[model samples]
Target: MAVVGGGIGGLAAALALSRAGHDVRVFEQARAVSEVGAGIQLAPNATRVLRDLGVLAEIERVAVRPEVFEFRRWDDGRLLSSTPLGAAIEQTYGAPYLHVHRADLVRVLAGAFPAERVAVGRRCVGAVRRPDGAEVRFADGSGTAADVVVGADGIHSAVRASLFGARAARFTGYVAYRGLVPAQRVAGLGLGRRSTVDLGPGAHLVHYFVAAGRLLNVVCVLEESSWTREAWTDPGDPAELRAAFTGWHPTVRGVVEALDHPLKWALFDREPLPEWGAGAVTLVGDACHPMLPYAAQGAGQAVEDAAALAACLTGASAADVPAALARYAELRLPRTTRVQGMSRDNGTRFHLPDGPDQLARDEVMAAAFGLSPDIDWLYGHPVPASSSGGREGARRG
Candidate 1:
């Protein structure tokens, strides 16, 4: 198996397949594997998959386990709701919600695979499927044929364009500024130890500790008419960011003010693809269905995809590859599509304008956070067992 794009999804697919006793090679366009941002929230579903893959212990060492997720008003720091996540979530879901540095998680996955198996700077130009296998061509005028090709390239996937042709990604009309500050620095500002979301009129601020409380990751998303660029590493003007949340709560301003250098990303998402597999090739992660950050499941869903793909392909014959790929798609498509829709809906709900609706939303959140079952469907559900082979897949599914 050959996995394209050495981001988290690609590396994860390579690791999972190799662990399943297959020879897998991962091709990454970057010179090295490194994440651009500060933090990623790994809900229980994703953590359980990683735990099964045998990387959970290493992840836990560097990840922060927050006790609660608190939502507050942007104007006066009034607490609207708080969801208990540490013990309650683990007891219900079978795993803890982990907040870790993106780079740390990438390192964990990359280290699990043999160094030589990951070919960096090998940009995938296109791929062609044959009766026997699939041929992947790289921009450096080289090619490799493998029994299966997985396109985990992400939202701007080259393999996706080569297969489905070019389709514009819908801009959500929002720009996000993200940065990480030393936790000690945040503490000096008198900010308490907690995960916080300050909901304002047209924007919101999410702050949380990561890297086991060594650093605080801050993300601020605001509605905008146009974007300067789409890159996650684009330089952002802190002054502009401060101005956007000018009159926000003092805590919100303190989090933004603690930033040294911040990067801005123009948020965009796509409707779920009608198909994820073609011949001996299939797509995973953002390449198949990109979602907004509201649900904090963009990376989580990709990790889920990797686990499902590995489960479907394990112990399958060459003739069974197509059926396996279809089964993977059939199992993942509906769930991811629902998540994508929910993320969009949550974005609107979070940025609701002032009215009875906003008041009602606040009331609902205040009440929902107190209940254990209100969020069980999201944080407690496990991935369904794979159904490729009758009993074996069922056991792992």
Candidate 2:
């Protein structure tokens, strides 16, 4: 098996397939493998998949486990609702939610694969499928053929372009400004070291500790008429960011003002691909479904894709590869599409106009948190060692 793009999803797919007793090689475009972002939230669904792949111990070592998730008003520190995440989360979801630096999670996933199997600086240009197998072509005019090919490249995936014709990604007309502030520095600003999320009319801010309480990851999102760039490292003016959240709250302004260097990304999403596989090739992660970040399931769904792909491939014959690929799509598409829709819905809810609708949203949130049911249907899903050739089942723990 050949896995392209050595990001979290690619590395994870390589690790999962290798553990399933398949010979796997991971090709990364960068000179080295690393995550260049602030923090990533690993809901129980994602963490459970990581644990099954055997990287949970290392991940937990560097991660900060928030006791609960709080949603508050942006004008004043008024707690709208809180969901217990430590014991209640574990008991209900079968795993604890973790907030950790993206780099740390990448390291844990990368370490699981053998160093020799990972090839760096191999930018995948496209893929060519043959009767026997698929050949992954690289930018340097080199290629490698394998029985199976998995594209875990990000939103702009070369493999996707190779299989399905290139289509423009839908820009959500929103820009997110992200930065990492030291925990002590945040404390100095009078905002205690708590997982705080301040929501305003058209903008919101979420802050949490990462790197074992050493640093705080802050993300501020706002609806915008236009964005200048799509890259994650695009320089953002602090004044523009402050002006977006102007008159929201002092703490929110303080966090944005304290950012020495903040990065901005114009959020883009795509409808789920009609299919993720063709012959011996398949897609995973953002390559298959580029989702809005509102649900924070972008990485989680990718992790799930890796697990399901491995499960379907295990013990399959060469002739069964197509069926396995079909099974992978059937199992993944419904849930991921639902998540994508939910993320967009959350965005609409978060940016609700100040009126009775906003008050009704608050009431709904409070009631949902108070009557929180077991989320095992979403979090405790287990990848079967083999596809049952039946419709996938959604069951709670």
Best by TM-score: 1
Cα error, candidate 2, residue 236 (Å): 1.3
Error of 1 at 128 (Å): 1.5
Clashes of 1: 2
Per-residue C-alpha lDDT of model 1 across residues 75-140, encoded as one tens digit per residue: 888999997888877887899888999999999988888998888889998788879768789998
Tens-place lDDT per residue, model 2, 1-397, is 8999899899988887877777889999999999886898888889888888889889999998888788888777677888777677778767778888999999988888898999999999888788977889999999999888999988889998999888878778777889898776667665543567787888888888888778889888888887556454587788888888787777777888777678887888888787997999999999998888787788888889988998887667788888989999998998888888878987888888778999998887777773244344566666555332322321110
Which candidate's lDDT is highest? 1
TM-score of predicted structure 2: 0.93
Worst-scoring 10-residue span by lDDT in model 2:
388-397
Please give the range of 10 consecutive residues that has the lowest summed lDDT in model 1.
Answer: 388-397
